[model samples]
Target: MTQKAKSRQEIAEEFGISAKTLSRWILKEKLQIPQGLISPKDQELIYEKFGKAISK
Candidate 1:
């Protein structure tokens, strides 16, 4: 089966934050990111910590 993927923008949108902020968090190890997209392993962890962002 193919793995699912989510862009930085989508992940940020889910946390109500900017992509830049998410990038910084990844750099600082504040967020769990493997690369350009959020890995499936970290998806649940992210939502557990930050919940969902209000999409416009």
Candidate 2:
């Protein structure tokens, strides 16, 4: 038996944030939180689109 990968909501819960907030960060490329929480691919995608983080 093997465990399935967690969903976005599950990931957000682990980080103590809401799924919507997580989506916002990912979609808008605003990663203002701590490191090691986000995947490298996501980081690269965000950086590629937004250049840098623009916190709100």
Minimal lDDT window, size 10, model 2? 1-10
TM-score of each: 0.58, 0.44
lDDT of 1 by residue, 1-56 (tens): 11577788887876778988877866675764577666766766665666645545
Poorly placed runs, candidate 2 (over 4 Å): 1-4, 30-56
- Residue 19 in model 1: lDDT: 89
Reference-based lDDT, each prediction: 0.69, 0.53
Q: What C-alpha lDDT, on a 0 to 100 scale, does residue 45 get in candidate 2?
A: 51
RMSD to the hidden true structure, all candidates: 3.8, 10.5
TM-score of candidate 1 relative to the true fold: 0.58
